[model samples]
Target chain A: MANARVIVITSGKGGVGKTTTTANIGMALAALDQRVALVDADIGLRNLDLALGLENRIVYDIVDVVEGRAEVRKALIKDKRNQNLAFLPAAQTRDKSAVSPEQMIKVLDDIKAEGYNFILIDCPAGIEQGFKNATAGADEAIVVTNPEMSSVRDADRIIGLLESQDLRGAKLIVNRIRMKMVEQGEMLGVEDVQEILGTGVLLLGVVPDDETIITSTNSGEPASMSDTSRAGQAYRNIARRLLGEDVPFLQLAEEKQGGIFAKIKKLFGG
Target chain B: MLADLIERIFGKPEKTGSVAKDRLRVVLASDRSKIPPEVMDKIRIELIQVLSKYLELDDTALNVSMERDEDSIALVVNTPVHRVREVKVS
Candidate 1:
């Protein structure tokens, strides 16, 4: 807990897979033998619990812990699958105003005292009070974005805001990329997003769009637990990178095109 | 319909990815500077008024835009000057 790294996973735009990224990365970090505590800071719109398949296990929420109704440990729900992973769900009946920045800092401090090596806060969308509360106690940030114009623009805005708050060196994670679309020039590539966002934000990892992610979410199982899922492998790599391991990005283009290209070439008799 | 046919024959129109990049470049310049188009116009008009007191300017050719680079953003102004106004000593 003394050297625990408090990182907030955020994006300025909604529906860019912030909660999914948080759940998967937390699971991956736990798999790597790190003590991980995932805090859902979305307040009323609580989904990290469901994503981690721990929604039914949460008895006390963050509001209860902050309001003195329950202790921090009592509010935290340990992942049934992974002993190293724990989660604190947000209050479903409250809004963003239910918790203040100071209270969030205190809550994180409490979680840190529980001896977690990594405390990942799943930040809510928008540049509002929820965002502030999520980032208040964070030492670093992971900005998840989609390779789309609107998402990239919002990410730029978030980077600027984070810099103004003196929270510099926030890493980027471009999620839900369709490699074929990037190769065909129909979607924005990672380089275009990096160029538009500037170089201050470093690249953390890129998760490809995988249909298994949806199925895993629906089943309350994180995709990171799947060995065959491309998105899952990407999240696992991101976790290793967080642990100071140098893991190269997955060769997504080749993996996505190899089979199809071979078939096309054979059909052309080349 | 002719243009559409030509585009179809040409194997598709311009890639929208490049178009998005171009649009983002322009929009981000203004977004980063915190200056909207109306504010930019106001700044241009005020600049013209201040410069007119000392120099004769060609307003038609004047240009003002926020230019962005990898490190910084600059309010680039290209104001063509017609002539310098002579100052009279009392």
Candidate 2:
């Protein structure tokens, strides 16, 4: 517990895959034998529970833990698939004003006392009271962004705010990247995004835009648990990197072109 | 198929990626400095007024802008000074 890490996953723009990143990375870290807790800090608009397919198991939410209505252990829902993974859902009935930044830190401290190796908070979109609450207890931060113009600009804003809070060295995760578009010079590449975001933020991982992610999310199973999903593999690599393992970035463009032969072989059941 | 073939042979006319990067560079420089265009104009006018008392400055050719590097953002001001005014002894 002394070395436990509390990280907040956030994006200034909505629908940039902040919740998905938190769910996949949490599951992947659990798969790597680390005790992980996924906390949904999006109070009014909760989705982390649904993403992890544990929505039905939520008897109490984070608000309950903060208000002393329920203990931290009572509010946490253990993932059915992974014993080491647990989730704390946000209260849907309440809004962002329901919890303050100080209360958020108290809740996280209680969760930390449970002996989790990693606590990942899924921060709500925007830079409001919700964002402050999500980041109040975090020692580190991860900024998720798409390669599009608007997303990149919002990410730059979030990075500035994080530095102002003394949360330096926040990692960057460029998600939903279309390699084909990047190859055609239609979409921004990883290097372009890094240059725009400046040198303060480090690259954590790059997740390709994969269709399997849609199917996996629909069924409450994150793509990170799938053996064939490229996005899933990327999430796994991110987990390894978090554990201090040196792993190479995935060669997404080459694999996409060379996968023709592999596709043909799969059709023949080879 | 034909379009793909043509693109492969001649390449795209313009890369939107570079355009987006260029636009973001200008936008973020202003966004991080929290200075809008009107504020920049005000700062320029104030600089010209203060400097004109001590020296003759070419206000029309004066320029004020923000330059961003890897770790810091700088307010870069470029002004043309014609001559310095001598102060009378009181």
Chain B TM-score, candidate 1? 0.60
- lDDT at residue A139 of model 1 (Cα atoms): 92
For residues A16-35, could you state the per-residue lDDT of candidate 2 as single tens digits? 99999999999999999999
Q: What is the C-alpha RMSD of each candidate to the true structure, in Å?
A: 6.2, 6.1
For residues A144-175, could you state the per-residue lDDT of candidate 1 as single tens digits? 99999889889999998888778899999999
Error of 2 at B51 (Å): 13
Error of 2 at A51 (Å): 0.6
Model 1 CA lDDT for position A100: 95
Docking class of 2: medium
Which portions of model 1 show Cα errors greater than 4 Å? A253-270, B1-12, B35-73, B76-90
- Give interface RMSD for all predictions: 0.7, 0.7
Per-model TM-score versus the true fold? 0.82, 0.81
* CA displacement after TM-score superposition, residue A203 of candidate 2 (Å): 0.6
What pairs collide in candidate 1?
A: none
